[model samples]
Target: MVFKKLLSAFGVGGPTVDTVLVNPNTRPGLALDGRVNLVGGDAPAAIEQIVVGLVTRVEMESGDGEYAGVMEFHRLPVSGAFELAPKQQLSIPFQLPVPWETPITDVYGQRLHGMTMGLRTEVAVARAVDKSDLDQVNVHPLPVQERILDAFARLGFRFKGADLERGHIRGVHQTLPFYQEIEFFAAPQYAQVINEVELTFVTSPQGIEVVLECDKRGGFLSAGHDVFGRYTVAHTDADRVDWVQVVDGWLQQTTSHYGGLRAQGFGAPQGFGAPPGYGAPHGYPTQHGHGGHGHGHGHGHGGHGRGVGMGGIVAGAALGAVGGMVAGEMIEDAVEGDFAEDWGFGGDEE
Candidate 1:
């Protein structure tokens, strides 16, 4: 998608900018190739700089409650100062390197419920209002990550929703200030004890750190609480292991006796080994106790009542079963509305 806007700061005869993405679909550790096209209006103008960044909506906790806002996490400068003559046209090509820990916005061709991502372009003038544009961005999952997701579907776990939380996961390395949580309703076999499961993936060149937060059901005498589990898997293991069995084991270990595992500070159970050069055992505290300043309840964008069955998901049915079309339209609207307001570029600048 492409977005074009006039330089409002420059007044009537100001320059205009149009950002065009070569392709919107990409994965983590990849690059989004695009060009910024500029056209002079009726008069010449001095261009200060041109930049592009990745933006998304994140749920943050406040004193009263939680609110969602747009945030730019990664940016790259495309061009420096330059001069444009009357009616002159120029194009600046750029390659924006996606971060290794970038969140996934799409799975199999279906947009994930409650997830939205975009690439924003900003062109600053010497003393004029900066012109900006935004285009939707789609990020797919890595092979290993996809395998794990498929495993969940095979296990009868239903897709509930997903959202970005403005906080870090304890005992995990993160380049950004927030993390993505893919939530799922519990499968029938484990519904007796588990209500839902939240999954997080922190990726690197070597491998990925998988974090699981399980919401346990209350027992006759015990109160309900959240259990945390962490595991390490290599990219090469994407095709080597039976992901169904592995994920099932992880769920069993996590929901059964997470207290003992937390005390031991261990990695995955025996037989599931971490790749060479992997870090030490990852120990995660209870959900409410960690995350630096405590985690907030996420307000997902899509309706939470809709449920996506495992059979449908595994068969390539639209994963956005919870009104994906509506969610997609909402994403586009957010790109032009929420992003501009949050970035402080929609109104007058001081």
Candidate 2:
């Protein structure tokens, strides 16, 4: 909560800062409320501005592999042209806007463990000195996000891990340098389809982009390849989508179409080159990419995370179900496991 300023710039008896966030935990589209307390030095000074930034930890991709770093995702100016008299106290309250694509750091009231969000406050002063402060912030799931998460729990995919990765999904139009990947183990019905699944949600003013990747089983005489699918659901769909049915459909459609071919469904698959109809993913609503010939997509997590607990499969008659299904597990492996080694853990800096 303490702001760090260049004391040397202000000479001796320099002022100090501490930023207190009234509401650290918030949703993707919610606002962050906080106040910056500034204690002036022995001399009076003209304050230039107060800046707030949202910082996140993300993985970067490199030819040698991946790396990690704390990157500032967004910034806003809270105030400007102010004055702080000698030995005077000033408080600057601010409500910063959260980006629509902001990553979700928690689910079911559980912190993703490895994930961390910080509010950085920067104070600009004339000659006396300037200082900045950083405080931790927590991001909760959106209503639609919660609906989808609960559906996953109901469907029996245990949580494994979650992290942001550098690089595009071949066809995603990303404004930021990286994207977040929420990994989950497969349920019983979808077992034969593959080992696990990774979900990514990209949002904008218009709607959200849901990406699903499935690691399907190879045929009796063939090696199985991974298949991916994407869905464009609007915020209004939060209560409307039978996520269970929608997700199930996605899994089935993805596996059946991209089975072993080079096609990726709906969105771009890692290495399948690019989809014919889909443009970049960042500009999602514009392209609505998912499904098509997706070669060996860029997902390198494999099936090395954690073990799943026993859970019942989907309701009604069992379809072409196979393999032992996994229950909904908390994000144990994700928060504890080293993502940098497995995927793009922290590739944002470079």
Candidate 3:
């Protein structure tokens, strides 16, 4: 998508900027190619610099409340010093690298509800305010990620909702400030053992690390708690492994044990395998914040079609059941917010 904005910093007849992204759809570790088109106004202006940044809405937790904001995580300077005569036009190109740990915004061409990503363009003209524009960006999942998500559906796990949490997971080698949690409702067979599950993936060049936090059910006279399971899968495995079997085994092992697994020397027996509960030093702690059995909460509705496709990947039956549900209004809320006047981008000084 392209966004154009006038340089109101210089008042009427000031310069304007039109930022165009060749393609907004991309994956982690890939580069987004785009160009910044600038047009001079009535008067000649000395351009100081032009920059582009990748921004997203990140959820944050404070002492008293939780809030979300537009965070500029990656910045790229597109132009240095330049001069634009009256009616002069300039085009500067850029190749911005998407971070390896970037969160996934779309699955199988469908936007994941609750996720919002964008690119911001800032042009700094000498002695004037910086003009800015924002464009939406779609980040698709890596092949491995798609395979895992597909497996969940094939196993009867229903898509619940996804969100970015404020804090870093205890053991995750996190690069970004927040983590994305793709949630799912338990299938009928696993429902007796688990209420729901939250999934997270920390990706690197070598492989992707999958984290599963299952809301395990308690037996008679027992209280329910979360059982955390962590697994690592190589990208090459996307074409070779049976993700459905792998994911099913993960669910089985996670719910099969109420007592901690690491404590008993039991480790992850699925996927590429990491020690059980790899999110912590001694396995997952007993006190994870996600202890709620969140059914009937969040958007898993009709916003994005949970299309049933069965070829290499099988969309689970649960998705077909909830496929028609509407996405919640929260996604719109996340996209609609007031951006900062300056966005921390400095105006041209010379």
Worst 10 residues of 2 by lDDT: 320-329
Q: Write the per-residue lDDT of candidate 1 for residues 1-350, one digit (tens) a residue.
A: 01122433435677888899988877787789899999986666788889898877667676877766667778899999988877898988999998888898877567787676778888888666667778778887766687688789878898887877877777788888788899998999999989999999999877788888899988999999888788888765654466778899988888877633542333754564432221111221111111222111211212211123232563453343111111111132324556455332221111
lDDT, residue 221, candidate 1: 95
Error of 3 at 127 (Å): 2.1
Greater TM-score among 1 and 2 belongs to 1
Work out the TM-score per prediction: 0.78, 0.69, 0.74
TM-score of candidate 3 against the unseen true structure: 0.74
TM-score of 2: 0.69
How many times do residue backbones clash in model 3? 6
Q: What is the C-alpha lDDT of each candidate?
A: 0.68, 0.58, 0.63
- After superposing candidate 1 on the true structure, give the runs of residues whose Cα lies further than 4 Å from its correct spot: 1-10, 259-265, 269-311, 314-350
lDDT of 2 at 176: 61
Question: Among these predicted structures, which one has the highest TM-score?
Answer: 1
Kindly report which residue pairs in candidate 1 clash with one another.
9-129
| Residue 19 error, candidate 3, Å | 1.3
Candidate 3 residues lying further than 4 Å off, grouped into runs, are: 1-10, 258-350
